[model samples]
Target: MRAPLRSRPGPGAGHHQVLFFIAECVPFAIALVVLTIELTPAHVVYTGPLLVATPALAAVTMGPKGTLAALGVAVVVSVITATHNDAWGGQQVYTNLVALFLVGAASVVTSRAVQTRRESELNQVRRIAAAAQEVLLRPVPARLGPVRAASMYLAAETGAQIGGDLYDAVQTRYGVRMIVGDVRGKGLPAVRAAAVVLGAFREAVHYEDDLVEVISHCGEALRRDAALAGAGAAGDDAFREAFVTAVVAQIQEDATVELINRGHPPPLVIGEGSARCLTPAVPLPPLGLEEFIGGPPGRLESYPFAPGDRLLLHTDGVIEARDGDNTFFDLARAMEAMRGRTRQAFLEDLRDALLEHTKGSLADDVALIVVDRVDRSDPVRGR
Candidate 1:
């Protein structure tokens, strides 16, 4: 089996640390070299300016705390080196003190400016990501052609606007084509893979004549991107490991729903105070993991989705979610708890149950899509 994709650390935290460390050390190293060469008064004056400027540079790159720490180190180095050189008093000592004080003051100002700019950039990126998430996985309308739907997405990582989990629905000539998927990783690479899959799924759902063809098209798109990246040997395994597990379905006028499962957990069909899994007859390999001579795509499975039938499709994040005791979430048990509940109640109850099961924290991104066929006997809004 291929190794799972590892999430990259955020730039703001890790990058700041590395840059701050380098910035703090550079001037200290320069001072040491000057001391070795027998530091002169002229050298002391020139080096003093650099000692002050070094912490300011650190502030610009790493913000306030880092700048303050660098400044403290600079002061200690200057006082110790000067004392050792027998130049601790007189005009020379005053010059060093003035430089140290100026460096600390400059660092304070620069650090505040850098922190303000960083916060602004972070806010802007979060806004953009929020907009992108809404566009990519739109809220399921209160009602579709013959179904009422609702969905929820919760990213695993805190402050993460989006991740690899995806869902989409659209009214096409065929019917209400919908899908929910989970890419193999987290962070930007997984997000990029999700974008590729979702972009292809949207285009294919409207244009492709068959659901199987639509799934194949999405797989082909990812494969092409992997090849282009020269991910040749390394890329091939990455694509395989970065596979997407998904379930795609279409609802017909008579309430007959057809669906295909690609290595995804089966969706649950809830009706008449009972819940059951809609397992596909022939499950196919996940997208982006096609073997050299892959078997034909799975046959579309069909079932009668009578009025009041609520179908719940979700990523493994739901089942895989764990509690403090390390117990996995039992979705079936939760559904049983909500037996005979109204659509809205069912959703709310399920969300609450899941949150409780995971103790409000999940290790993977969770996406839930619920589709319910409305009762036809109920008053028709318009003939």
Candidate 2:
């Protein structure tokens, strides 16, 4: 496979940071140039305009305090240049000082106003994102019916708490049903698709007895959402192509799991110090492409999730992560290495391992749900 594109910053990030530092120092650099020019014996060029521009340039990146600091340096340099040139009593020098003071004051006030407005907008965005996360990705209960479960969502984009990857688990009359899926696109469109699928799963899992029917409901919801979204934007049929790869699994009280995979990475069953992928017997297209099947719903494959066994459902982000050498992350090996920890700890260690393998740069959003089958008489020790 071609190298995956990472959302997190890479080697060039340091270079960009260096350029930013240089930009911030531009105001100081201007002051130094003025001082150097004044010290020259053959200097007839007036440096007043350049000195007056220093604080305004600093205001672009630095806040009010930094703007004031730049102004102070400009004033000190102006005085020294005036003394060196013996132009202290001249009207031109006095006019230049007055202009510098006025410009510096204006720059400081503008910088303070911009900083306040920016902070307010940032707070508003953070609040909205937090609310969206709670509704779109509700936390899976640590205990669901006969199993103990935990989930984690890692968004590849910086400052993003949620993304196209989504998962949810809920106790139902039939059994404990759970879903793990990834949307085909990114940003708002992908988030909208993810919300539609998850909303369908949360509602259908309780009423739909058959696992296949639950998945069918999710598929129908995706199409309806796409049609509605497409109606608003003229000539924007992109939503029609936005599909979601998902796996819906139901675990009965007897510790047996029935899964219907929709073009997603197969779930893992870990037990006795080994892990195995529960590949689906009959493959089905992703949710939006259900028309391609042209028959009954996807087959429900069964697996013996015995007591003490752990089931892991995840998006492709976990397995497709590549190290510096282009080798895929060894998820099975990592899971085996962290087998005996508690559900929460196991997931934390797994996340750390994934990050370490990719050096903290992930190409896609990751969503994971781990379910453990425990016998009530003898609760699993580390669970």
Name the top lDDT candidate.
Answer: 2
Q: Which digits, one per residue and each the tens of the lDDT, describe model 1 over residues 1-383?
A: 00112223443656776876776677556546545543555444445665666576666566677677777777776776677777666686678678778877877887898789889999999899889887777776656677767777777665776788988878888888888999997666688788888999999998887998898888888877766655455544544457788899888788678888889999988777677888887768888887732667667889878886878888998899888899999988787777666555666677677777776766787777878887645543221
| Candidate 2 runs further than 4 Å off | 1-45, 234-238, 378-383
lDDT values for all models: 0.75, 0.88
Tell me the tens digit of each residue's lDDT in model 2 across 112-191.
99999999999999899888898888778887778889888888876676889999999889988999999997777788
The deviation in Å at residue 67 for candidate 2 is 1.8
Clashing pairs in 1: 231-235
Per-residue lDDT for 276 in model 1? 85
Model 2 — which ten-residue stretch has the worst lDDT?
A: 1-10
Alpha-carbon lDDT of model 2: 0.88
Tell me the lDDT of candidate 1: 0.75
- Looking at model 1, residue 186 earns an lDDT score of 62
TM-scores for every predicted model: 0.73, 0.88
